[model samples]
Target chain A: MSKEFFTIGALLYKDYDLIDVNATLRLLGSLKDNFNIITITQTGEHVKSYTPQVANYINYNFENCPDFDILFIPGGIGTKYELENPVFLDFIKERAPRVKYVLTVCTGSGLVAKTGLLDGKKATTNKQFWDWMTSNGPNVLWVKKARWVVDGKFYTSSGVSAGMDMALGFISDVFGREAADEIAITAEYEWHDNPHWDPFAERIFGKNI
Target chain B: MSKEFFTIGALLYKDYDLIDVNATLRLLGSLKDNFNIITITQTGEHVKSYTPQVANYINYNFENCPDFDILFIPGGIGTKYELENPVFLDFIKERAPRVKYVLTVCTGSGLVAKTGLLDGKKATTNKQFWDWMTSNGPNVLWVKKARWVVDGKFYTSSGVSAGMDMALGFISDVFGREAADEIAITAEYEWHDNPHWDPFAERIFGKNI
Candidate 1:
């Protein structure tokens, strides 16, 4: 059988901080040879931006994102709003079985928790909001100290900036460490250096008592 | 004769906030039909996680950026550090004359102002840092109230997220408002609701006070 490689679907909605949405889109776009990716908004519109090769975007209702090799969820300030929606959660639960990979970044892990996908599974989110995830899904093993975490098919990552690290890790899993390393080198990012607790965060929040 | 189009360059750095970079990339990427989009990075190596399809990523050197139709500078914490480099400023001064369209967002505008490119031009930066911008670029006409400002070939925007709005406006200038609107609509960005402020500056900061 053919490898049947395919595009990744990034589900988006209102208050979906355009930065995270676009970051994932651009990262996935860079890996075009290995994965076809597009952004699907709540209105079922395939959003197009500066990328023309990505002109023919595929749009879908939040609850109707199509079957794809990977389902990516980027986090933002409005993540709490998504967790409160049963329609969105139900769709996530329904599609969990079809996607080979389920990825969540920043507060996006909360959505997976709402779907019960992370029950008794290891996960992570913005350290500032870990309590919210813990409160919503008590059974999940919350790794607050991690930049990214993996449990079964579910992959979760810390805050907005860490999304790139999580995505690179996913790309590493799918394509190999070398490919991931290549991308990190191109961006001048320390491929594996993830200081989960930023010094600024510690300064602002006061290092865990 | 084909319409004179310019390639806009955005510098992508490691650990840079993914979303901020994406907002600008998406807008520039979408305008490829009318503009050539080139991304210059401090590293020519592989960039994992975020948007990594930088047309030409250079490594640790200011000399690698190509002469473009336009120069786009997106802001983030990266700007905080990049702005401190004198070599980078020299590179900007050397290239500013070759390109007619010079644009920046958030702290990135500070770097532009530092190069004295916007010395006499009207511009803006993140609202929280308006005073800092004025202090840094004493001669520039700092418009603390505008979301995005266009003065001659110099364009600057306020804050990180606002880069997309500036990019859309820039696209409209080159591709017509209709094409820009179509791209925004497909992206589901509400097309008309920009989260930038100009009048708010006068009200909040008191234009004269």
Candidate 2:
């Protein structure tokens, strides 16, 4: 039997690039077979893809969204616009309780944090705008030194690739270390004992210290 | 003046799932200003946001695409079919010479290898198919231990998130380490100084030693 999963992207249609956005979708979809994943968008349009599976689009117009075992919110520059939209925030707030996992990549955490669900919860963002993220959602424990953070029901990653780690991390948490290990092995990831830090970073930042 | 940069995806039809594809594209687009990136599809269709960028949708079916400074190809199950197409192989061979860089994510490396570009070069792929990757492309050094591998002009990364690393790695190679460092810092990734390797692989197959 295949496990069911859904990943919702908060695409606001502002100057966002297509590479990273598409990258996140592809990585999450890698979980297919074991998990049936679909895309959620706010514009209520059918997403066209050269590959149709990647085009399985869902519209979120403040009224309907399929029940997702895992609700993912990927970030973009438009996240700034999303943060201020109450309808989107309200939609997230309503669904927050139903999902087994609440995940965010890059600045997507900022949008969910705005819903007040992450208040007092440890979270993270792209780090380029940590100050802005903290100011936007002051109630959560903002972890600065992290590639991704896991606190209770919320799993937030630092930036683009971190989202993949967050997805793998969630799979590990729910299915067991073996599943995560297989995925990582298949993906050729080093599988950081801790996804939070690495020596290359120390080489770069250690200098400042 | 803004730098003239663009990203291209091998838009194979009817395979990839929207969740991972769109999320990756969206997040990558958010990095446009940083990379000075614009994106065009294989059919010469420019992509705008999560939708196609070109209006005419002229479908300029070039025998081989015109030159660009950077070219990126993403993989899905469809890549297996793509591997058998000689036209795609010729197309990659024709366009590769003119581009400043060639990059791929996941199994998309199969396409790159099919072009014979990485025959004797060091490379990697989605972990599950490392053996197939090695068999398909002879003399290709299997850096089975790396999440991503950079062999001179040819750069290949392990499945999924490794693409993010490849993108950032390509940016660093072209723009300089400083630019890559800034991007890594902004993204909050440590730059996995050592490519991701499974510690157990060495021990599990100790006889190879």
Tens-digit lDDT string for candidate 2 (A1-209): 23654444334334232333454444444555545444455665544332211233344443465665767676656677767878778878888888877778877888888888999999987766667776878888887667678998788887665666676677777667787777665544555547666343344346342
For candidate 1, the share of real interface contacts preserved is: 0.25
How large is the i-RMS for each model, in angstroms? Answer: 11.5, 8.9
Q: What TM-score fits each model?
A: 0.51, 0.72
Candidate 1 lDDT over residue span B1-209, tens digit each: 23666666655544344444566666556544566555566554323322332211222335565567777676655566767777667767777788878888777788788877778778887765667666778899887666688889887876654666777787777678787776564332323224344443554577673
Cα lDDT listed for each candidate: 0.63, 0.58
Residue A30 lDDT, candidate 1, scale 0-100: 48
lDDT of 1 by residue, A1-209 (tens): 12446567777654454445555455544464667664566666533322432221234676565567778787765577778888777777877778888888777788888777888899877656657766777878887566678888888876654665676777777677777766654333334435353432343346782
TM-score of 1: 0.51
Q: lDDT tens string, model 2, B1-209? A: 23645544334333432222343343334344533332334455333222221111112244343445655566555567667877666777877787766666667677788777887788877666656656667767767666578877667776655665665566655656677667666554546434554343353345353
Off by over 4 Å in 1: A1-20, A23-209, B43-61, B192-209
Highest TM-score against the true fold, candidate:
2
